[model samples]
Target chain A: MGETRLMKGNEAIAEAAIRAGCDAYFGYPITPQSEIIEYLASQEPHKRTGMVLLQAESELGAINMVYGAAGTGKKAMTSSSSPGISLMQEGLSYMAGSELPCLVVNIVRGGPGLGTIQPSQADYFQATKGGGHGDYKLIVLAPASVQEMSDFVPLAFDLAFKYRNPVMILSDGVIGQMMEKVELFDQMPRATEFDQTWVTTGKTADRERNIHSSLDLDPARFEKHNHHLQEKYKKIIENEVRFEKIQCDDADYVLVAYGSSSRICQKTQKLAREKGIKAGLLRPITLFPFPYEEIEKLANHVKGFLAVELSAGQMVEDVELAVGKKTRIEFYGRIGGMIPTPTEILTVLEEKYLGG
Target chain B: MNEEIIIAGFGGQGILSMGSILSYSGIIENREVSWMPSYGPEMRGGTANVTVILSSERISSPIINTYDTAILLNQQSLDKFENSVRPGGLLLYDTNGITRHPERTDISIYQVEAAAEAGKMASTKTFNMIVLGAYLKIKPLVKFENVITGLKKTLPERHHHLIPLNEEGLKRGMEIVKEVQLG
Candidate 1:
């Protein structure tokens, strides 16, 4: 519906940030994701859209800058790879505790520490189960394509502000580095609408001064704040569970995957179907409020569920929980930046579940 | 037809750009396309490669194990991707820097002396265009006119004046390409 261009996922997200009316971007360069900041820097968004772009001294500085900008009701964001994201955990936790709205992009690479720059979904647990130290969740949206890489920017920004919570676009190096045809949305004018109640734009005579701090000395008050946050999380889980079911109606077994793994699983489904195996794919677009219910519903009819990921079965635990003891749940993953072929995944499924 | 190709060569040989051209041409034709490069550390001191997929329908995975075609530019590429091409699929290569030639009998092998062709045009930068022209000559996945348009779109404005030279190299490549072996 818009101008179609062959663009890399990183470049598309950068341009989408500008089009999304983002106020500022604070980030450090990291492999597989440096193109994001580089593309933003090349566009000169400051001149084009009055958007601020800064290469911070470190990921800590970058994420804290996002926290500060978000506190002032600015549409702010930051992006980094696995290691840099690890460094930003403290700031992320602080922002979540302070109830700020912003976007954080993690173009995941293989890692426990200093891992290879190749793509991996090892960050699934870190992203969904809380990378930071608390019972807080960053509404994580997993993009499976270059188009979604562009589309999720505005979507994450909207979700961030709507719930006054941080939203992360959890992607991997493969999706970030790959180029595909994407129809980018049209440009929008930037406006600082001070309509939100919690944002501390400025103190004025007509309004009471708003306090912005995550620290609560009283335990009861902090517990009350956490209760409110949990209620918000419940609302998000109820409303924002987005996923795609491919050929599930007649499926004998289902492949549940997200992000890059899901894309590969789509092909695996085709291969399995060609081999007379009724395999389907379930792709979760929202990894935070994951398609747990959908997987549960599919398990009611499908005899087996395969949890395919780039990690050693991190999301498989969630799959097990969804399927329960009634259905068999198997997991197949390739770690340390090595990706499994479609056939390899299919073979794993056939051996694990079908007793091949 | 869905063309899943991998172009492999050392850096600065336009392997990534070759894939980009294929992708841009697919976009112009309103076909689904994806271009994925080898950004891993192997690209630091070794060969660089890119996987390109063009399809009439949606392309599910951008990165895959096998390829419909492998346009190799050097010995390392040929060694790496020779067996990766599907049986009866195309394997185009340049005879410039290749030491050991392809030994694959399961795939159709073709040769294009891209460096020699680009030498005639007095610019090694036109090398990739030559290989691209040779590939298109065999497959014609995208029309030649659309490729011209794609070249215009892919090249920056500063390099626009070199289009005619690239065009010449392309035509020379199309003329000189030889079918070495059939599957």
Candidate 2:
């Protein structure tokens, strides 16, 4: 343990960014997540680490700022709610196509339009399925607790640069606003030493001019770029999938959930087990490189799967793809900022699976 | 022991700060703790509440609908969360302007005149502290010394001067809280 403190998930992430030696953070203020920028401003990171913190005019301005900084191989990140993230889709697509590294955080609120300012998992498809045009994928990390909010900043940045793609920290309002005990890490020195070989640092006399662009005028060249991106995603999929399994050793029913819903499902597991239902929890820390293999393995023993979320049903579709028809699968959800009760989830499980 | 508590009232009632202080106290005691507030725009008008859970073990859900204890501060909050208290659990409240008190026969009900008590000494800003004192007196979930540390931790450096007043309000609250009788 480094230094223990009780902090809101949003504030914890900002403090983590400073500790991680992040170079710049460009974001606007939004409810449930404004604390991220607020905490950053309060600490005056520009004075502490020489980190640049800016309030761009709009979400569009903020993300493009991230795009420009990341082009030079500098660590850059932006955070916003659902609508703000939606606006950044175009920038995310370009970052993916250009093979640039950056971090984007979506402290998701309920949405299709300007929906309620409640927590939601409806952004699953947008994050994992390439919300923007063209075929590309972002490495999405879903944090369920306030502690994970702090821990994931450095991890997200690492994965982003390692893969040369944007990394999205997908969380909901619950995790964003809640307070919990967190052990903040010691400060790491800001990244200074760089090869400056592939990315554009400066065109010196020693090296040839480096070109970076998502636009390939020739169809054949664009197709080649797509192939390269697909290969990268394939490698990431093979190596980067992360998840957690609880009580699965003796499970009869498995609950598949991510982020805050997973925490709720954990309670559902306890209540179900006490009632002799033999329940378990599978929490996917990485929502993009989902825990498909793990769920398929559990299908061999469990009676069925319950996909719990704060949306009507989005991640459930992914669950269907993983288990196929190996076992019965059901969905339980609440939307528009409404969080489901653990007892209600258990009741839904009984009615869907155990009821005759 | 796992103590899942819900504190509910309006904004400016120190509703959020009370939770911050209590949950930070859990940190001083080196226990697993979480504080989740009804932090949406809905809090601007109606009741605002925060769920605080302190446990020896890991906490599962921070968005639970029910709690081991419900500390309500007004008529609207009592109406909203009267049934949220667990059977055989504690339902402590302030009977300041309460038109409808808790009627649950299965739970223990206690009332504190926090508004008047706080007004007697200073502003109603200390109202929430008085209620916190009363609850701690009944439950003693967090040690009093640790609570003082919690107050110190949650309050900013500029507010260090007010710790003694809040401490006094806590002691007064402990003295004035009365157990309610159910007919």
Candidate 3:
């Protein structure tokens, strides 16, 4: 337990990173997410925790800085919106290939190209299935509230280090801009000592020099590395399937949603239950190691499942893949920054399941 | 009880601040609250609005189309959100520069001459406090003491001196608010 204060999600993420003993924050400003960097800059984390806070010229530059810092075994992070995150995909791929642990936050906004600054969950496929060119995955945590926005920062870093992989806090503009009560934790000192066997921190007399690069020219070596990466991802999927089920014990109909859409679905579940329709919500907290097993188990008993999102059927594909042909899985979404209301979701449920 | 309110006005009219203060008041009263403002280009001199939700339990959604209360500070907000208030809900408007009056008969409409009072007090900055005062007089969702405490928490130490003036403006607003008789 800590001091509770009403704070914005973006600001909370910044403060949480500082409290989590992050070594550095390098980010470029973007709509719906600029607050993260702005808050960090204002707090002067350099003064408070001897952390390095630099404003990079571009998202590419910021992510590269993170890759450089993480290569030295330092806890580093960068945040941006969708288009900006797209710019960092190449860098992210390099980091994943090099097995670097770092945190990247995407406070998502609607986009195909430089889209609106309103909230959206359109980056589901881009985040989970690997936006970069590789057989790799980032541990993606989708936070639905300001509290989770704060809580997930440390969790993302812990997991990123635990698996030696990049982690992403997949939030949206709604959560980034919204203000809610959050209990902030006490400050933890930055990790001064960690296993630096693989870190490039200048070779010692007794140790062999370590080189950090993803450029494996030998085909067999690259294939072995890919297999190793696949093994790690398999371990992550087996060990890190996190989700929250609300009223799902005897649900006749279930709604699969995440991030801000999950909050709306929670309300829709209550509205449906009030009308005698048994609706439940399964919110995937970990989007990468998605709760496929839970969804599959639920599919056996539930009559149907509706995948609701702030995008045109993105996560619905994952839901379909998870449940297979056990039950009917439908998708209802609003794209281009348009959020579907609870009433709209309820109406869809009625039209699809209940006799209107 | 849950109160989902939309406070809309011009960018410089402290629309967002009012919502923030209301949310802080909810915290003071030990209630769950959320304050979400419309950001980006619209916040630059254009109409700005914030959705403030206060509930005894955890608030699920911060964004909602309909509202239990619509506090319109200008004609644009009145025209935009007048119909969004739920039936038997409250629509409080400051009779400042509103040209088109709200015509919703299903909801309770109240007018507060907050702008005129603020002008008389010679400080346009206190205008939002007056409007907030009117909302409190009508709904009384949070205690007046909690509102004052919320004001202290929201204001910086350098601006703490203005609290008395805001308190005066709030009292003036409470006195000037009048319920409209819908035919």
Candidate 4:
């Protein structure tokens, strides 16, 4: 524990990035998430830790800047909301193809297009199923609280570098704008020594020249590279599945949710338990990994599962797949930036699972 | 004890700040606290609202439709949130802008002339502080000293001079607030 401070989620992310020894931050200002870049700019990280903080003209420019810096083995990151993230998908795909390690924070807002700036979890498929064009995947971490927002920055960087892949922090307007007390971590100096064998930092006399490009042109080479990427993804799936189970051991029903929706589901579970419903919450901390095995195990004991989200229905598809024909999986959500209240979720649980 | 509160008013009325101060006070008392503000276009000048939850144990959700307490500053807020107060909960409102008083029979209602009182004060910025003061008087959820410490944490150092004035406003609010007796 470094220091306990009452801060907004976006501010926590910015401060966490600095403490995580991030080498550079490049991002455009967007509502519900602009505070991240604003706080970073105000801190003058460039002055404090010699970190580079640049405000890109657009989300595209910011993501491409991340790509450029990450290609050189620097801990670089960029943040954006829904529409802006959509704009960065091309860059994200390119980064994934080049196998560059970088962090992308999506403080998601409601959207098929330029939707409302309020919170929404509609980007589940966009994030977990590869928003960008490719067979590549980003290690997506869903942070539910300001503390998680702070903690995930460093965790994301570590995982990104370990796998040599792009990682995304899938948050939303609620988590971005809400304020809560968070225990921050002590400052860690920028990583000075890491494997730079694949970095494009100019060739030395003794080392072979390195190239960072997504295009192989040769079909055979590209196919082999895709296979290698698939192998890495398989390893991540086996080891990186992270989920939290609250009162799940003897639960009759389970509530599956992520990010902000998980917070509401926790309350719903408590309410249900008070009413002798034997409810539990299964919160997937990592959306990309999906925590399929955990849900499958829970399905054996629970009567049903409710996949709650801030969107109409996205993650529920994955839950259904995990539960298979063994148990019923239902979805309850509110769209267009509307957040479902705890009572609403509880009412849904009562109606759908409690046979009320 | 867990208190789920909603503070609502005109965007510039400092409703969000009041919620922030209350949440900070909870933190000062080592309670789990969350303060969530209404974001986006409605916050520009329309009715702005914030949901604040303070609990002895970990807080589950900050988004709530019903509240244990409601601090309403404007008529719009009063109209919107008067019914949102749970039965036996408290509804605190400023009489300055409300045309219709809260009609809830099951909940406790209190009135404070914070806006008119702020008009008499040196600065109108202490308006929310006065209402907060009344809230503390009714519930006394956290210690008054904790609120002072919370103010120190929430307000920047340069704004420290206004703390004394805000405290004065809070004291005044506590003195003047009156509960509406039901028939």
**Over 4 Å off in model 3, which ranges?**
A192-194
User: Which structure is stronger by TM-score: 1 or 4?
Assistant: 4
What is the DockQ for all candidates, taken in turn?
Answer: 0.80, 0.89, 0.82, 0.88
User: Residue A38 of model 4: what lDDT?
Assistant: 91
Model 1, runs deviating above 4 Å: A192-194, B41-43
Off by over 4 Å in 2: A192-196, B41-43
**Runs with alpha carbons beyond 4 Å of true place in candidate 4:** A192-194, B41-43
lDDT of 3 by residue, B27-126 (tens): 8788999998988734557889999999999888787889999999889889999989999999999877877788878989999988888888968899
Give one digit per residue, the lDDT tens place, for model 1 in A19-54: 999999999999989999999988999999899999
Output the TM-score of candidate 2.
0.98
Greater TM-score among 1 and 2 belongs to 2
Candidate 1 total steric clashes: 0
Clashes of each: 0, 0, 0, 0
- Model 3, range A1-356, lDDT digits (tens) per residue? 79888899999999999999999999999999999998998899989999999999898899999999999999999999999999999999999999999999999999989999999999999999999998889999999999999999888888888888999999999999999999999998898344557888898999889888989999998999999999999999999989999999999999999999999999999999999999999999999999999999999999999999999898999999999999999889999999888889999998998876
CA lDDT, candidate 2, residue A12: 92
Residue A350 lDDT, candidate 2, scale 0-100: 92
lDDT of 2 by residue, A1-356 (tens): 68999999999999999999899999999876999999999999999999999999999999999999898888899999999999999999999999888989999999889898888989999999999999999999999898899999999888888888999999989999999999999998778344446678888898888876889999998998899999999999999999999999899889999999999999999999998889999999998898889989999889999999888899999899899999999998899888898999999999999892
Which pairs clash in the backbone of model 3? none
